[model samples]
Structure formats: structure tokens, C-alpha cells
Target: MNQSAGAAQHTHRYSVEEKIIGLFLRTITQVCSAFIRTAAAAALWSSRLQMLSEQSNFSDDENVPGSSWHTFSLQFGVWKDIGPVGPDRNWKGIGISLLVILVVLSFIGLSIVLLSKDTGSKTSGSPLTLDDLFQRSFQIHDPDAKWISAKEIIFQRWDGNVFKMDMNNNKTELLLKNTTFATFKASKFAISPDLNFVLLGYDVKQVHRHSFLASYLIYNLYTREVQELNPPEVSNSALQFASWGVQGQQLIYIFENNIYYKANVQSSSWRLTSSGQDGVVFNGITDWLYEMEVLHHQAAHWWSPDGSRLAYLTINDSLVPTMFLPRFTGSLYPRGTEYRYPKMGQNNPAVGLHVITLDGSSFTEEIKPPDGFHTRELYITMVKWVAQEKLSVRWVNRAQNMSVLSLCDTTAGSCITKHVMVSDKWLDGQNEKPVFSRDSTAFFTIMPLKHSSHGAFNHIAMISNHSSGKDVSLHHLTSGTWDVTHILSYDESTNSVFFLSTEEGPSQQHLYRVSVMDSSDKECLSCSLFRSNCTYYDAALSSDCQHVLLNCRGPGLPQTTLHKLSSMREFQTLDESAELRAALKNRRVPKTERRTVQINSFAFRLELILPMDLDETQKHPLLLVLYVFFFKFSATIPPS
Candidate 1:
């Protein structure tokens, strides 16, 4: 929907009665606040006057203490210090008394007004409508926090300014001002490894689910300068993809289907590949089939840890059938565009893994698949750099029934299978990247393990002797009925692997830290915090493993908080959704109930959201939507 349509749907006009009630409540609230402030001021003045009176107590014959004003001793000074003459004696005391009376009167008035409006305040507010839900009236505000380093975090404000916050001092400094590049709105940013330069992409035109064409620009944080990120051959043009390298200000981008590189923000661009076709062959980026079915990511490139080599996939879809989509705008007759989309029993795109050294000259070396696998029938599911010269890649067959994890030498472009997994049923499309040991001899990945009679649950297991090209032994690091959802981080300093799991329940996810040396030594980091409303959670750890950003995606309102790892204490609250909570306080929202239903040997969770005034005794229409595949896959993965 367009912006105007969205705004119109969220807008609501208040009824006459509602407007009147709202006006009355606002007026009463304002009056009560004013009265309270006035009463406080009056009480303060009365106390100060009493103190002055007590301090001004001086004997009339003592010529009054500090009596430099005795020169004006026309009886006025004596009268002023003492009291008024005649029936008006003790005038200062009387003034203090009047001030006290004023304070008491103000308090009494405020109390009466509050008491009078108590009944009105007790009335239930307006009923919640579909408009509220559509408008996301209760959605919490997130600060969009990202960790730039162990001791610092970068977050964007609502006004588009990015800020850097130091964890030690809790001080925030402006990193990027929105006004600096006000020419266009950037949809995303890629910060350099040094955190000195930011690559911004604007004028984004989405091509697929995760791919887009955007014009890129570079902003220097130190100099506060902005420059277009166009290659020398191309000026003011949109790029297919762009990102920073792992070291310094080195960067890479894809223009006209070809890969380009820059040593720094101010350096000239170099074309890395020349055999890129618009729809046939993709060099650094993925095509529709690879992006949607295999990798599930836009880019197929992986930079080495030292930024010395690049590993990317080349997908050729010339033999694949084309799918045409019609465009319905800018013409009387609709014009259509063609996309290479492979269907059942159709030719799949042939994929090849290639490695290129980035030391000035470039000659791409193709990394062949393992034995018994052909490049035409294989899919590269995951690519990760293990060391400066070693790369790990997972390849699955076209049927997705067999997967092979291999380690490749970047210098030779040769690979050897480290582990092989075969299943009678379809395997998980893309497995998570295995966290490798520092020495690259061992690694950790999630595999299904049988626990008692609960079938097989996904657990973390360490595989050793991977580098020896021998049969690796798997040792369980975590074993339970609950599934480990993700491997978040591995802290070498603490020898701890942090992960998220459904230990609390099927609907809940919590962060956990487990020792690699001792699997039995495990602790739940986020379980004790927010036990009331928060259930589902996700986390992002800093590189040094000193801090984490815990996201509470909840049964109640979601919140994001930064926490210190050592103490497990909250360091900062990125967002608590205070405004959203206030907006929902008086709303008559729907009631929800959760229940577990046991059918034969399987237990299924059921959640029902009912109307606020629902009548259980009466028959009501039911709208039931079932996600069979998702539920079954999550329940358990039966072993082959």
C-alpha cells in the first residue's frame, strides 16, 4: 500500500461524546497538575518565611544583630524587626500564617477536584478496533542497535541520526547525522571494519525477496564528507550489491552483473570479473534459484578473514526455462519481463565455487565438488572462511537428501569432505555455519540427538579431527528434549559457546552459555530476567564477548536491552516501548488463551484469541489455519 492509504486506514475521527469526555479529562488533569505545583510552591514559601522569622529574633536593646541599618533608626527598623505597632502586632508571624493557609487551601482544592473526577476516571475507555491493530498501535520502538566493537555500540535514533555509545562510560556521541546525506534516503548501511567509513545505499529497487538494486555512497565519519560509490566506468548508476571488506576501508560492489573493488573510499575501482551476463551467469551475486531455494541470501561472495581472498559462486542459468511477469503500468498495453525460473523436472542452474586472491592481480580458481557429486546437480548451501587460506563449504544435492561439508584450500582451490550427512527424507535446506576452534582442528554444529523417548532433539555437538581428513568423533556439548535454535557466538577468551534454545517451552526461547571444555558446566543467562511477560528471545553478542544485546520478543510487549556478560546485569535499555504501553493501558483489547492438547502420542499447543465480550456458551464461527510442515519440522527431525 502507498503511504497515503496506510495513513488513511490508521486515522480515526472521534465521536461527539468521546471528544467531550476527552476534553473534560484533559482539563481536569491539567488543573490538578497546576494545583499540585502551586501547593508545593506555597508550602516552600511558608517554610522559608518561618525560618526567616526564627533567624531574625534579636533583642530590641541589642541594637539588632548586624545592625548596620541603625543609621536609619527612625523607629522603622525597630518596628520592622519586632512587629507592627498597635493591633497589627506580629505582622511577620501573620504573613507566615497566611502563606500556610494558602498552601492548605490549594491542597484542599486539588483533593476536592480529584475526588469529584474519581468516578469519571474509573470509566472504561473506548473499545479497541481493527484499525488499532492495522496501525500497529502497540508496536514497540526499537533503537536499531548494532555493536561496532566490544566496548561500543551504534544505534540509530528516530530522527535518522546514528549514535555511538561507549559501554564503560555510558556516553553517547553522534556518528552520522541524517542531514549529512540528505539527498536521498538510504535503506541500509555497511560500516567499514575500522568503523571510520560507512557505505550507504539509497534509491533501492528490490529485485527479489532478498536482492535489490541501489545507488551507493560513502560517508566518512572523521571528515564528515559524502561521495558517490560509483565505479570509474559507471557514473550515478545503481549497483546490484555492495559491502565493506574485513580490513580497513577495502570494499567491493557489483555493477552490471560484474564485481568491482576499491582499496579505500577514495581509491579507484577495479573490475574483478568480466564474463557477467545480465540473466545467464552471475559472478558475485545469486540468481533467483540460488537465492530463493539454496543459499537464502542475495550475495554469493565470502571474504576471507584477512581480506586477502574472495570465494564466490558462479550460477549459470542459460539452460533453465524462463518465467514471464507482466508489468501493468506506464503503457496502454502491458509489457512483461522474463525471469529464469526452474520448475519441477526442469534444468537447474549449474553452480561452481571459485576463489580469487585479492593481491592486485586476480585469476579465479574453480573449487570442484566432492566425488560422486556433479556441479550441475549440486547446490552450495553455505560458504564460510575458517582461516586465512581455509574455506568451509556445504553442498547439497538437487533433491536435498544428502549434504557434504568440505574444507577447501584457497591457494589450491581443492576440497576434501570433512563430514557427510545422508537422509531418506529431505534435509534442512541450509544448516547453520559451524563455529570452528582457534586451531581449526575442531568445530561445533547442531545435530539431532536421541534423548530418552522424546525422539531426536537438535543439540550442539563438537566434531574433532576435521582437519586430519579422518573419521571425526562427535561429542555432545548440549543434550535435552528442547531444541537449540541458534549458535549465537563462541568466546575464545572465556571458552564459552553462547546459544539460544527452547528450554523454557516450545513457545519460549532463552539465551544460554555452555563451556566447551566441560559440557556439564552450563548457565541460562536470560532465564531469570523478565520471567513475567517475556518468553521468546534472541541475542547478538559483541566480538570480545563482554556484552550482549538481548531482544525479548514476548507474550507481552517486546523489549531490547544491553547486558554485561560477566554480571548478567542490564547495562542499557535500548527500547521498552513506554509510549506503546501508555497507548494500550486504557484500550479494551482481545483476550488470548494458551492450551496444550494431547492427541494420541503427540502434544500440540493451541492458542486462541477471543473477543473481549465473547460468550462461551454460544456457538461461534471458527477460523482455523494449520501450518503442518512448519509444525512437523519443528517438532522433531526423525533420523534416517
Candidate 2:
């Protein structure tokens, strides 16, 4: 009996210990499974919230109720709301729960790292949309005449009112209102020399680069009267050319391929030339060949300084060939347009220069070409009045290897060759005009720099008009390794010639002043003027060199300023681009980098514009742009 009791007690104790061990393992499995479910629910909720946040457009004053932490807590409460422990907890459930929790937590941490890596750093700039391209902005128009006097400047506002800004206080005064003249919108206008009338061009159609056909209206400033400018013979036809005469309210215009004159508004129009025919001949206005190649101007006419004489070219194109171009405008059959085009070794237009006196008698004379040129084949490249009765003409051979600058006696109707420049290559005299001195006894022009070691560069040379014979005495006025681009103006008071030159750098053009008497007294006017903003400049000086209109282009936004010519101080700002600067305050703008690379003896200029937020370590695609004969390379990277 004693042995049986002992065995029963030991068995009971072992059974109790096994039950405790089982209970401990079950508790652990349940805890782990709960944790895994909670973790999975948390990850799923986070992903949903992230997606919603990305899709939502939140305003500053609005709140997102679904993204609050309280929502997350409520979701976790669903697991806790299920009562105490279940009896089926196992090791397999614990293992799966732990594995799932590890994966979800790892993924969440990786996502957090990736999203936070680029915070506070800039990304590539946004690409331009169609809206950016087609949208219009407020812009200031460049003044018609560069050297407009402060008293004569009149600006047309967007509301169709004319205003004049005061230079003393920067105040604006209304000159004309749109309500006064509602029938016409002036596309271009010019003030008469007397400042009493405005020549307005309306309903304009462009015919070429420098020519237009338009209906003209003359507005009287004092009387507030507007009248159509039409001759009695062709009342409704478009005028070929209309421009202000040198004096009073006088005007000259071209019509029906011929030149016409008006001494004043009340005077009857008089025809100056009667040899004009359609497609065969043109008077006072250039034909296609002359306009394209020789003159590069539509009106081949020039008025004398005193407004007494008019010199013009008469072009005969009857022998030239015609080229037809097709005009397509969504039509069933395309229309053809014909134009006179002179090809290589073909028949060119015959050109002649004629002068007409504006007196009541209407005397006319033809200034014949020099004896050396074939008048029919040669080109009358340039013409200018050097004096009241003397004119300067430049004539070039058809071979383009020789050019002669001649002085024509208008009274005698004869031309005398004053100077001749010959070039083994082609002489580029068509675009250059000789600059005469104040006394008209000497003239300046650009010639190759003698004994230049660096390379061939153009410098200013003076030719004496009082030469003994055909051989004129030439003197070098300026010499350097740099090239003078153009002669801006001559100041007779100071005896100084202002010009543009590439003296500071090859890509830079700055205003320079050099004395005609000294030649060594040189000054750079624009190099240090706008040190940071402008690298290229052009200037228009008043007749007396008292005022200047300076055009600053490049390196930054372009600016136009009115300045005192003597001091080079800014008098007024014409255009400051205030609207454009305000619009670009928050946007990314292109940045330019200019570099010069030297290969052997040649230097190539390169301009590179890279994308914003450029990455140096990554390879990027590039676009290269090259202009023929310019040797300029530019690269632009598109935004990603």
C-alpha cells in the first residue's frame, strides 16, 4: 500500500510541470502572432496613406482627416478588440508571423531612406510647355529714331494713346488719345522734320526685308486733322514708298514704279520719272537684283541735305530671267509667283544714277559711269551727296575685283574717279561708305592694316580730296591688331571719330573714340561703362554729338538708355525689362558659358548652355549647333 501511494504522487507532479511548460510556449506563440498581424496592418495602412497623400491636392487651409494618427490607432484597435487567448496557437504560426513582420519593416525602412535621400536638393528644371511658348508678354518697343530729341519723343501706349515722358521729373504727358482717331491703327509712323505732322502707315504688307506696301495717312498735330495721302491719278492704289522729306511737311513717295514729289501738303504731286514699266524698268526704287545684291535697300533714292535735289537709281530688268515659286494655301491648285532672278553668268539688270532738281522747272540729269566700266553690266553700288552740287558714287566691276570711288559734278553731269581700290580677292566696298570730314576735303574709310604681324585687320585710313592727280594721298588714321567694325559718327567740334571695334576681345564690340589729328589719342567709351551687364554695344549720336542712344545687348537682358554724349552718363532708361524680370523670378533661366579654344593658329568660339541641376558623374546626350562661315558652336541641353 505504501509503494503505490509514492508512484501516484511522482506522476502527478510530472504532469503538473508539463502543463506549465505547455502554457508558457502557448503564451509566447500568441504574442508573436499578434505582433505580426499588427505590423502587417501598420505597413498596409502606411502604404495606403502614402498613395492618398500623393494623389491629393492639399490647400494651405485644408486638413486631411484620413491621414491622422488617430485613424491608424483605430485600425490597430481591431486586433486588440478580439478577446483573450485562443487554444490553437503553434510554433508554425509564430515563425510565419515573425517572417512577415521582418519583411514589411525592412521594406518600410528602405522606402523611407530612398524618399529622404534627395530632400532639400534641386531636381532637373521643368521643361517648357506649349503655354510657355505661345503666351505673350508686355514688351517695350525700340524707338524709331535712335537720336530722338527729348522734346520730340512720343511713345504710343497700349491703350492707343500717345505719351511724352519728361526727362526732368520722369513724368508722362498725354499727347494723343485713341478716341480722337478710331478708324486707323498705325503700324509705323514718322514725324515730319518740322514736327507738325505725323506720317502714319496702316494696312501694311511686307514685300521684302526692307520694303512694304501700305496705305498712308498724314496727321496734323496742331489742327487734329487726318487725311489719306493719295495722288489724284491712283487714289486707291498702295504706295510703294513714302518717307519724310528733309524740310517742312514735304514728302517724296514712289508709285507705279516711278518717283513722285510733293513740295508741301497743299502742293500738287509732280512726276519726276516717266520711264517706269512693270517688270521691265523701275525708277527711284530698286529692282530685285539691286535690292538683293547691290543696294540692299528698297528705295534707291537719297535726298540732298538741303532738300533741293533727289538722286536715285533707274534699274532696267527686261533681259533678266524669271524664277517661279509655288504658293500653297490649302487650295486645289497651287498658284505660282514669278520674280526676276539673275543667276551666275546670266544677264544682269542695267543700272543708272539720275538726279532731279525739286525746283518748279524740274531739271533732271544722268550722272554717267566712268569710262572703264561697261555701264550695262557694271553695278552702281553706293551713292551719296558730298556737297550741294557734288555727289559721291561707288562703282564696281562685274568681276567684283575692282572698285572706284568717284565724285560726280551734278551741274556738269560728269563723274571723276577720285580713288580706286583693287583686291586680288573680292573687294567688299558695297557695304562701306566713305566718311567725309567737316570741310569735305578728306574722307576716311577702312583699309587693311599695314605691317600687321598678328593677322590681317581693318583700320581707318584717310584719303585727301585735294590730290594733284589720279594718285590720291592716303594716310593711316588708326592702326592696331583689332578691327574697326564701323564708323559710328564724327564729332566735328572735337575732331574725333567714334567707331566700334573688337579691341577688348574678339567677341566683344565696344565704342571707341580716336582723334583724326592725333591718331594716338584713343579712348574706349563702353568697355568699363556697364562692366557686368553689357559686352556688345551700339550707339546713335545726335547731329551735334550732344546726346546718344546706347543699345546694350547680351551677357544679360538687353537695355536701352539715353545718355549724354560728352559724359557718357545715363540720362534716362528707355527699356529696363521690368515685367520680364518679375515673371522670371521663380523660374529657371538658361545660363551661358563662353569659351575659346585654340587649334594651331586658329581660335574657335564656343557657347555652351547646360541643363539646370547638371550631374557631373553621369553621361548626358548633347546637341551641337554650327553656323556655316560663322565658326560659332553652340550647345543646348534640354531639360529632363
Candidate 3:
């Protein structure tokens, strides 16, 4: 008896659903058919009238009055004679045809309104205007803070004064007054390792992406004294770059393409290289190809952990071809400037790795590239100091499909290949600095691993550094369908590696910590915090890994905060962006939806920024924004 009742209910439900779908389809079909027929009839009569006028020789008469209309009227009369020949009959037929067309058009219009109502129209709020995009109503506040120590951070306030913030007590203190170095109109500043001296960069000028030229001044924090880095007697002595060493107040600057070293803020500068040639050889800095495609940074120098030895690249572009770009403004004749640009199958910059000692006895050692690259052109993509006596360098072939990571002995100037990565497709320059374990026996880097037929996703991979040559083994530290975007820091105390990953979704980035000893012991740090507004995030960990500086960037107004990792509690709110939140509360804003679509055998991440109120039945224009950088490609579609 129960089986019979169940079967009857199922049959009734299926019939009711079928009837509803049938009614919808039939209504659509009837309205469309009627509209098409009426439109076709009107179009036929218009085309016939045009054809008759074109076939008549009287159409060419220029001295005639309404000659084309007269021809059309004569054709109408011919048709009328075949039918019920009379003036009133002709008028009556046209009126009836127009009435039928109007009725069909009205029916089609009414059907669309009904369909929209049935589907539930999403039109409620105002639509975003063009001005809203250009002049964004939603403002994001960034602290632009950098960690100086485990419990301290340094940031510049809006008034240009630098402040020091303590993570423990949530207290802020002014470190440097804006007016102290305001005479030079300083635009950039870097604090020394001891946090005593500040290097002020002024009169800044752009060279290329992530590179600039500026005049620097050294400011004493206690004494409040300032002095120019370059001597006043020297003509046009702006430096290409300046940075403090990892220890004390040791300074290094590039002037006239040569690297110069200063023992301290009061010491005189000593030249390190004299082979710098104009537009030919670049010392301690990257050339066009290296900065644009390879290293993606201007600085080509690396200091050992103890700051005793320095490793730098001497790029010789004398053999490479030069391209002259003409400037047409501000002169009667155009001015041309030459740039070292290597085209396809051309000579790239000859890159040589050199290590120099700075402990009293100054000497230089040239480290040769790895085997199979001595006779072939190779690009230096990464350089890092693994130990006081050892440094790591990554070398890639001309096609960038193969990469070799070698650990070099700074004292002996000899390198042993530790790991090698090869791919059929081009390799993304591994520009990330690998975090070495406490014993320096292993290092963590991001690599791709195939997971469950979703294709390969980026995950954290740890390779044994103690093993030399190409026989090293890579162990997976983190795994999933999502990708690990960057490695933030490694804590030796907890044996945990912190990194940013798209574990939540592709459009969102959150912080995650995984134990190197146990791959399954992983926890998300930022997933539960600020769940409503913050989706994308960037974080920086202090040297001791006790605190984290987090930047919450959009799906809403951006926010910056500091957190104590031990308790997983928010230490402080740096910027709440209350003004921006208030401004957007009453204004219309675009909404973003993250979706993943499968095409063929590949899955692609798609982000759609739709209008506030979207009507499915109405036609809307689409705008596609494509961004291509390095080997990465992303697409954003917005309503137009």
C-alpha cells in the first residue's frame, strides 16, 4: 500500500512540472511567431515599392516634381486594379495591415515584461555611472607600514612625519619630523638596521620600472643633523640607488653606474667599480632585459647575512644592440636617446657574478655560471645569501625553460648546483627568496603539483639543500586545488612556514600556516577575521615571527591591522577607513562575483564586476579588461 501511494505522488508531481514548462514555452513561441510574420509582411511591401521605383526610367528625371513618389503611386494603382480598385479600398487595406503589426508588437512587448517578472527582476538600486569608475567613491586606506623588529614597525603618517608604532601596547611615537628633511623635499626614506640613521631620498627621478635616481641625505635621529651623501663639488651626482646594509649603519650607493661603499654615516664613500660605461655596462644594477623580464627589480646586489661579503652582478651590454627612441616635444628637432635592447636571437647582456670582501682586506672573486651555461647565454634570476660563507644563485637559459639553483662558497668563489627545474613550457622566473631551515639543510619554495585531475596548482615544496647536483628531492609541504602565492616567513621555534594562498577561493587571498614536519597540520590565520568585508590580503611577518602586519585589500574598503600570532588576536587596527565607508553607504557601487568555468579540459578563474541592479531581460554592453604581466594573465569583465 505504501509503494502504490509513493508512485502516484511521483506521477502527479512530474505532470504538474511538465505543464508549467509547457505553458511557458508555448507562450514564447506564439508571441515570437506572430511578431516575425507581421515584420516580414511590412518589409515585403517596402521592398516592392523600392524595386518599382528603381526599374522606372522616369527616376532619372531631375526636373520632375515628386517623380519617385509619382512612380510609386502608379505601381500602387496597378496593384489596386488587380484587386478591389478604389481609393477608399486602398486606404482601408493599409490601415488593416498596420493594425495587425501593432497588435503583434504589443503582444511581444507584454510577454517580455511578464517573463521578467516571473524570473524576478534584479533591478532595485541605481546603476553605476562612468564617473564612478574614474573617480572612485570607495577609498582604500593603506598604512604602508614595514616591520623593523618583532615588536616594532615604522610608518610615515599623512603629514610626512615618520612614526614608530609598538605592537605590544598599541602606542605610536614620532621618530622623524617632516620639516627636519623637508628642505630637500625628501620623497623616500629608509631606516638603518640600528634604527638610528634615516636615509632621505629627494629630487627623485624615474629611470625604469622599480628603478629611480635621487639625491640622498643622511639624518641623525638623536642629533637631528643632516648632510648630503654626495659632495656638493661633484656635478650632477644624483645616485641611481641607495640602501643600508643588513648590519649597523653600513651604506651602499650607486653613482655614475659604479657601486660605492660607506663604512658608516660619517665615513667617506669609496668606489668599488670603475668599469661602468655610459649605456654599456651596469654594475650593481639591472639592465633593461634583466629588469623587465628576468629579475624584475633594479638592484642586482646581495649582501651576506653577516654583511662581510657582497655579491653583485656586472652586466656588460657593449656587445648588445642599441635602439634609439626619439622625443618630439620641447625642441625644434627631435632628440634621440639610445637604449640597450636585445631583440630575438640577439646578444643579451653578459652577466658575471662577483663577490667582494669588505673586512679590511678588500678583494673580489668572480663566480662562474653553472655547467652547460659556460658557453651558452644565461640570465641570473635570483641571488640570496644562505649563510655567512655561502650564497645561492639561480641561473636560467636563454629560453628560460631550464633553471639551475647553485650554492656558491663566497670564500672559494666556487659553486655547486644544488637543484634544477626544467619544463616543456617556459618557467616563471623564480624570483622569490627561499626560506632556509634552522640547520640550513632544507629550503622552502613554491612549486606546482597536480592534484586530483584539476591540473597542476602551485604548492609549497621543500627541497633538500644539503644534497648537491640534480639529485635533490622535493617534498610537498602544502597541497590542495588552490595555489600558494607567496612565502611570507618561516618560524624555527614552531617549525611552521607561513605563506599566502588562495585556499578560500581564487579571487581571495588569505594567510595560512603549515607545519613543515606535518603536512596535514595546517591552519588559516586570516580566514575567520573580518569575514564580511576583507577577502584579499597581503601580510608581512617580523624577523622573529611573533607579529604580523596585515593589509586587507578589498571586496570592500581596505584596512590595515596588526595581529599577535600567539593568541590569534588582533593587536591593533591601523586604519579603519571610516570616511570611505561612510561615503559608499549611500552611493551605488559595482559588485564582483567570482566564478570558475571549465573549457575543454581546463578550468579558468573568471571575475565579473556587474552593475548594482541588473535586469536579465534587458540588453547590456560588456567591457573586458585584460592584464598581462610576465607570464601571468588575468581578465576582468565589467558592465558598460
TM-score of each: 0.73, 0.72, 0.72
Q: Every model's Cα RMSD, please? A: 13.9, 21.8, 19.7
Q: What is candidate 1's CA lDDT for residue 179?
A: 78
lDDT of 1 by residue, 1-640 (tens): 1122322343333345556656665676576667666766766666445534544453243454444321112274442334321122345545655775676566556656654454343345677777776664565566788876788888876456788889889998887887755755776776787889998888989887789999988887888688998878759998999999878999999987788988888788888988799999999999987777677788999999889888888889989999887777889999988889887889889998899888887877888898888878888899999899999999898898899999888788888777788888787735588888878777888877887888788889888884667867878899988999899888888889999999888989999999998999999999878567787888999988888998888887877888898877655787777767888778766666665666689876767676656655444556555443112212332322
lDDT of 1 at 301: 95
Off by over 4 Å in 2: 1-140, 148-183, 328-332, 467-471, 583-587, 597-601, 607-640
The C-alpha stretches of model 1 lying farther than 4 A from their native spots are 1-142, 181-183, 325-337, 582-591, 597-600, 608-611, 614-640
- Model 3: lDDT of residue 197: 93
Best by TM-score: 1
Could you tally the backbone clashes for each prediction? 0, 0, 0
Worst 10 residues of 3 by lDDT: 80-89
User: Per-residue lDDT for 1-640 in model 3, tens only?
Assistant: 1122322333222233345655766776687677667766776676565445444544466345533333344463464212211112234446666776677677667666665553332343355566655653443545579887778898865456788998777789988887866676887889898889999898899877778889888888998787888742385478998999989999999877788898888887778888988678889998877887778888999998888888999999988998887767788999977888888898888999999998757799999988789423888888988888888888888887898888888889888877788999887637877777766678888877887867788889988845445456789998889999999888988989999999998788999999988999999998868567788999999989888888888776777888888765655777777756765554566556554666687766666666655443444556544433322335544434
For model 2, name the residue pairs that clash: none
